[model samples]
Target: MAEIVALFLALCVQLLALPVYVLSFLGLWDPFCKKVFFPFFMEKTMVNYNQKMLRHKQDLFRNMMDFADPSGKLSVLELGTGTGTNFQFFPPNCRITCTDPNPHFKERLAKSMAKNKHLEYGNFITTPGEDLSQIPDASVDVVVCTLVLCSVKNVEAVLREICRVLKPGGAFYFLEHVAAERSSWSFFWQQVYRPTWALVFDGCSLTRAIWADIEKASFSEIKLKHIHAPFPWTPIQAHIVGYAVK
Candidate 1:
C-alpha cells in the first residue's frame, strides 16, 4: 500500500511539473508561475509550512518590527514580495512599497494590501530584486525580505541594491532558505536535485550560500542564526533569519 501511494505521488509531481517546464521553455514562465504555480504552492504547502515556521521565527519577526520607526512614519520596501504574505507582520501605518518581477502578483498583492489595512500601500514596482533603479538612494527606512534570495541570479547584486536603497542605520530583515551545511547528507541531495528544482520553481536555487553573501555585504552589523525546518516538498530546509544594519 505504501509503494502504491509513493508511485501515485511521483506521478502527481511529474504531472504538475510538466506545464511549468513547457511554459519556461516558451519564455512565459513568470506570469504562469505567479498566476498558477505560486498560488498552488501557497495553498498546498506554503501556507501550512510558513504558519509552523512563523512560530519558530516569531522573535525574528518581532525584532524586525521593533526596528521600524515607532512613530509609524517610515518607508518600508519589500523585495520579491510575492502575493504580499509578509504584509501582516510589518508595523502599522508604515509606507509600504512592494517590488516583484512577476507582474501577475500585483493583483494578489492588492488583495493582501486591502486586507492589511495597517500597512499604507505606496507603490507596486514591477522590478527584479537585483536592481532598484526606480528607488532613490538612501531613501528607505526598512527592507523586508523573506524566502527570496535563493532565486536571484546574483545574490551580491541584490545585497548591493538593498544597501543602496537603505538609509543610514536602516535595517534589512530577511528570512532565506539557503544551501545546507556542506557536511550534511541534505547538502548532497540539494546539489543533486538543484537543477531540476530550479527549472520547476522559476529559477529558485537551493544551493545558494545566501547567509555568506549577507554576512560579507556592506552591512554595519548582522545578527543572524541558522535554523532548520523539515518540509517534505523541498530538500533545502536549512534557513537563516536575521537583520542587517546599513
Candidate 2:
C-alpha cells in the first residue's frame, strides 16, 4: 500500500510537471515556476510538512538569532528565499535581504513580508546562490538557507559564497532534505527517481548528500544533525538541520 501511494504521487508529479517542461522550451519556466506553479503547489501541499517542522525551525532560529546578536537585532541574508516562508521565524526588527535567481518571486515575497510585519525588509536581490558578489564580504550577521542546496548548480560554490558574505564569527543556518541511508529502500527509490524529480522540481535532486558539502565548507565551527523529516514522500524524508559559524 505504501509503495502504491508513492507510485501514485510520482504519477501526479509527472503530470503536473508536463507544462513546466513545455514552458522550459520557451524560456518561460523560471517565471512560471517562481510566480505561479511552486508557490501554489507548496501552499496547497506543504501545510502538514510545514507544521511538523515548525518546532525545529523555531529552535534553530532561536539559537542562531541569539548567537548572531545578543540584542536581538540582526542583519540577515536568505538565499533562495522562496515566498519568504522563513520570515516569521526571524527575530523581531531583523533587517532581512532576500535573494532568488528568479525575479518573479517579488510579488509573493512582498505578500509574505506584509504578513510578518515585525521584521524590516531590506530589498530583494535577484541572483543565484553560487555568486553573491553584490553583497560585500563579511557583512551580514546571519546567513540562512533552507531547502536550497539540493537544487543549486554547484553546492561547493554556494557554500563559498555563504562563507564570503558572513561576518567573522557569524552564524550560517541551514535546513535541507538529503539522500537517505545507502542501504534503505528509500535510497534505492531516490536514485531511481532523481532525474525526473530534478526536472519536475526545478533542479531539486532527491539523492544529494547535502550535509557533506556543508561539512567541507570553510567554517570555523560546524554543528549539524541528520534526522528524518515528516514528509509524506518517503524518498525525501531524510533531512539535516544545523548551524555553522564563520
Question: TM-score for each prediction?
Answer: 0.85, 0.87
In model 2, the worst 10-residue window by lDDT is 41-50
lDDT of 1 at 172: 95
Cα lDDT of all candidates, in order?
0.80, 0.84
Over the stretch 170-201, how does candidate 1's per-residue lDDT look in tens digits? 99999988989887767766765665577777
Output the number of the lDDT-best candidate: 2
Model 1 lDDT, residue 17, Cα: 76
On residues 91-162, what C-alpha lDDT tens digit does candidate 2 reach at each position?
Answer: 886899999987766777788899999988887899999989999999999999998898899999999999
**Candidate 2 has what TM-score?**
0.87
